[model samples]
Target: MWIVSALFAAVIAIFAQLTIPLPLIPITGQTFAIGLAVTILGLRYGSLSVLLYILLGAIGIPVFSGMSGGLGIITGPTGGYIIGFLPAALVMGIYLEKTRFTSSHAIIANIIGMCITLLFGAIWLKYFANLSWPAAFTSGIAPFLIVGVLKAIAAALAGVVVRQRLLSAKLLTTKTVSH
Candidate 1:
């Protein structure tokens, strides 16, 4: 489990580097990876994997967006989004774990998780970036709406297929005993 968690954490880091620089927060593949991790790993291990990734970045490893890491990044303007990853994973994991992991359920769960992430991120942006609510919304949430939904759907489907494949291969347990 720990090994898998570590691998997922590493995967998150890898995705984090796939960034397109923006004014405030760069767009990256991190969220898709987060959704994937939670859907596949479920609550306990999924959350733990994100926590592990955060810890690694917080400890000064270059595991965050743009290959940057350290306590500074966690406290930086985009830090809230980074911090938001934890709850996002937890929410998605819990929902996926409880439901049948159908396409609809998975998409809905990931969408909810994405909203949580945006809320945290936007709130943090308002404070850290010294922006008003409107500004925060424009900068933080607006840019990601369409892409977020699309990514949520993609992540959900990919996660479900991957989970099924892993289960069949005995690399993962059935949903009931997963994690």
Candidate 2:
């Protein structure tokens, strides 16, 4: 489980580099990686992977978006979204675990996760960047809405398919039954 979690953490790092620069926050593959990790690894291991990724970044490892790292990055204006990944992963993983690991459920869970990330990000950006709430929403959350939804759907579809293959190969284990 630790090894798998570590691998997922690495996946998050790699995905983080797939970024599209924005004014306040770049559109990166981190959210997609977060959804995929939780969808495939479930609650425990999935959350662990997110924690590991954050820890790596906090320790000055260049594992975050744009290959940047260190505590400053986490404490910066965009830190909220990065920090939000943990709870988002936890909630998403729990939803999938409690319900079903099907694509539909994963999609719903990932959307919820996306909102959680955006909420944290917008709130954090408001304070850290000294911006108004409306400004924060405009810069932090608005641009990501459509793109986030599309990423959530992609994560769900890809995650479920990959998870099914892993389960079939006995490379992974799950407590919840897939639909």
Candidate 3:
């Protein structure tokens, strides 16, 4: 599980490079990675995975977006969004674990997690970047809405499929009954 979690964190780092840089926050595939991780790893390990990823980035390991890292990056304008990943993973993991891991539930969990991340990121952007609410929304949330939804759907489908496969192979287990 630890190996898998670290690998997923590395997957996030790789996706982070797939970026479209914006004025404030770049659009990247990290969110997809987050959704995939939470849906696949479940609550306990998913949260740990995200937490480990954050710690890696915080220690200047260049695991963050754009190959950047260190406390400065985390404390920078976009840091809030980065920090928000933890809670987002935790919430999504918990929500998904408590319910059936169907496509619908997965999508909803991802959406809720995405919202939590956006909320934290936007508020942090407002304060850290010295931007107003509208400005923060424009920079942090607005541009990503459509892409976010698409990512959520993709994550749901992929997570469910992969998890089912793993469970069939006896490589994974879930609290819920076998689907």
Candidate 4:
């Protein structure tokens, strides 16, 4: 599980580089990778992956969007979104774990995760960037709404298929039992 979680963290770093730069915050594949990790790894391992990713970034690893990293980025304007990934993954993974890990449920969970990320980001932008609430919403959430939904859907479909294949191959367990 740790190895898989580490691999997923690396996956997130790679995806983070696929950025379409925006003014305040850039659009990146981070969220898609996040959704994929949660859908496939479930609550414990998925959240671990997110935590590893954040810790790597916090320790000066260039794992964030645009090849940026370090504690500064973790405390920067876009930091909220990055930080929010943990809770988002937790919620998403929990949702899947509690219900069915179907494409439909994954889609719903991913969409909910997206909103959580945006909410954290907008609030952080408002304070860190010294922008008004409306300004934060405009720069942080507005531009990403449509694209975020699309990414969520794609992540859900892809994640479900990949997870099934992994399980069939005995590469992943049905669930991680708590110690």
Candidate 1 vs candidate 4: the TM-score winner is 4
**Candidate 4 Cα RMSD after full superposition onto the native fold (Å):** 1.7
lDDT of 4 by residue, 1-179 (tens): 89999999999999999999887799999999999999888889988999999999999999999898999998988999998899899999888988888999999999999999999999998999898999999999999999999999999999999988888888897756221
- Model 3 stretches astray by more than 4 angstroms: 175-179
The residue-by-residue lDDT of candidate 1 on 1-179, one tens digit each, is 87898899999999999888888888888888888888887888878889999999999999998789999998998899999999998888888778777778889989998898888899999999799999999999999888889888888999888987888788888643354
Error of 2 at 129 (Å): 1.2
Q: Alpha carbon lDDT of residue 90, candidate 1?
A: 87
Residue 161 Cα positional deviation in candidate 3, in Å, after optimal superposition: 0.5
Per-model TM-score versus the true fold: 0.95, 0.96, 0.94, 0.97
lDDT of 2 at 149: 100
Query: Any idea what lDDT model 1 has?
Result: 0.87
Clashes of each: 0, 0, 0, 0
Candidate lDDT values, in order: 0.87, 0.92, 0.85, 0.92
lDDT of 2 by residue, 1-179 (tens): 88889999999999999999987799999999999998888888889999999999999999999889999999998799999999999999889988998999999999999999999999999999899999999999999999999999999999999999999987876543233
**Model 2 misplaced regions, further than 4 Å:** 175-179
lDDT of 3 by residue, 1-179 (tens): 87878888888888878888887788888888889888887877777778888899999999888889999998998788899999999889888878877889999999888888888899999998788999988888998888888888998889888888888887876543223
Give the top-scoring candidate (lDDT): 2
lDDT of 1 at 11: 92
- Residue pairs of candidate 3 with colliding backbone atoms: none
